[model samples]
Target chain A: EAAVTQSPRNKVAVTGGKVTLSCNQTNNHNNMYWYRQDTGHGLRLIHYSYGAGSTEKGDIPDGYKASRPSQENFSLILELATPSQTSVYFCASGDVGGRAEQFFGPGTRLTVL
Target chain B: EQQVQQSPASLVLQEAENAELQCSFSIFTNQVQWFYQRPGGRLVSLLYNPSGTKQSGRLTSTTVIKERRSSLHISSSQITDSGTYLCAMGRNSNNRIFFGDGTQLVVKP
Candidate 1:
């Protein structure tokens, strides 16, 4: 089975602090995605990358940014964290097209105070 | 525009029972995928039925493209099945999948 691993499984940050969550996927899938999970809202897509050095906005990308420095890694950066950003973050990888199923990472739980 | 939507925001069931979750999409989605997530855990792909019907183990999924809707049926529900079932749909041009809020299922022994 393909494995997607995320670092900083748990993080606590003060408001206005900068935070970065990292994800690494061994599947070598061409598509990667970042999402945040909140109560009642389900999982909202924050950003996605088609490949290395490419990033695109998703439905809720206003408070977040993404970086894909390499094909195996993707990072989510919060310039200035806020309490509203306290949520679980997930990383996923998929095939070249959307038709394929995505493999997800263990996820990171972030708390902004 | 919020293209995809799911029904039964939550569900409670007993062991050995049956459960059905529904999902609807406003846009003309070419593919539909269903995922299951345990509390505080990552999502696992349960089914990826673009259209028609497919079955795996005790889980079955059916998608009606013309109707722009899909359904996931769980047979002999187990306590381990308690979690959230999320439905996502993807179109031809946009490989990004639009997700529904999901249906939280709680199974009691």
Candidate 2:
């Protein structure tokens, strides 16, 4: 199985506080993505990395940053968290091409208070 | 604008009943993937149907490239099958992924 794991399955952060969510995958894939899921809106892409040392903004990348320091690790950063940022974040990894299906992580539940 | 759209935002069914989920792309797409999301959990890839028909377990997916649409048929659904079904479309030759809002399913015993 392609395993994608996330850290701090649950988190609570103060407004304007810094928050970081980490993900690790053993799939050895080249593409990784960060998505936030909210009610009514469903899941929206926040950021994605094509490979190490590269990151691209998704449809909704405001107030979010991504880091791909290595092929196995990807992180989503929030420099100034707000109540509106409270939601579940998911990380996914896939093969080099879009034809391959992405394997998603367990997801991190973030609550910005 | 939502590039990928799914019909019947929610569904409720009884055990052993069948369910059909639909997905359509706003524009042309070369790759289509279906996923299952448990309540407050991760997504599991159900079928990666680009075109034609594919089956896995009690699930069957069909995609028609010319029509730019896909459907998932669930036969004899169980309570464990209750979850949200998501559809993702990838632009032709490009890897950009677009997601649908998903169809929530609830199965009652």
Candidate 3:
């Protein structure tokens, strides 16, 4: 089975604090993505990486940053957390080609106080 | 601009009943994918059909690429199938998937 894991499944932080959400995938897929889900809005893409050391901004990338240190690991960084950023974050891995499927991680619930 | 929109924001059905969910997109997308999410759970890929129709078990999905629309049909719906159904589309080479708000389904016993 294609497996994707995320760390700090739940967290609570103060405003202006730094928060880092980590994800690791064992599927050996070439693509990784970060998304946040909020009420009323659908899952919005924050950032994605094609390969190691390569990252690209998605539609809602304004408040987030992504790092792909290796093919199996991807991270989402929130340098200055805010109350508005509190939400459930999901990490997914996929094959980079057009016909490939993406597998999602269990997701992390973060709350900024 | 590219966008994916789902219809009937929510639905309630009795077990053994059939349910149909609709999705439409602005502009032509290169690919379409359907996902299911349980309350406080992860998003699971239910189907990926760029065009035409495909079936797996009790779920069937059809995507009309040229018409920029897709539909997911669930036959004999069960309580276990209750969840939010999401429709997403991929445009251009970026591989970014735009998603709809999802249709929340509740299946009564």
Which candidate number has the best lDDT?
A: 2
Tens-digit lDDT string for candidate 1 (A1-113): 46899999999999999999999999888889999999877788899999999999998999898999999999999999999999999999987655656778999999999
In model 2, the number of clashes is 0
For residues A26-108, what per-residue lDDT tens digits would candidate 2 score against the true structure?
Answer: 98888899999998888888999889999999989999999999999999999999999999999999876456568899999
Q: Which stretches of candidate 3 lie over 4 Å from their true place?
A: none
Which has the higher lDDT value, candidate number 1 or candidate number 2?
2
User: How high is each candidate's TM-score?
Assistant: 0.94, 0.96, 0.95
Provide the overall lDDT of each model, using Cα atoms, as 2-decimal numbers. 0.90, 0.91, 0.90
Task: Evaluate residue B76 in candidate 3 and report its C-alpha lDDT on the 0 to 100 scale.
Answer: 99
lDDT of each residue in A1-113, candidate 3, tens digit only: 47999999999999999999999999899889999999877688899999999999987898788999999999999999999999999999887667546789999999999
> Distance (Å) between predicted and true CA of A93, model 1?
1.0
Give me the candidate number with maximum DockQ.
2
Candidate 3 structure quality by residue, lDDT tens digits, B1-109: 4388898899999999999999999878758889999988999999988889999899999999889999999999999999999998886576677788899999999
Superposed by TM-score, candidate 2 places the C-alpha of residue B76 at a distance from the truth, in angstroms, of 0.7
Candidate 1 chain A least-lDDT 10 residues:
A94-103
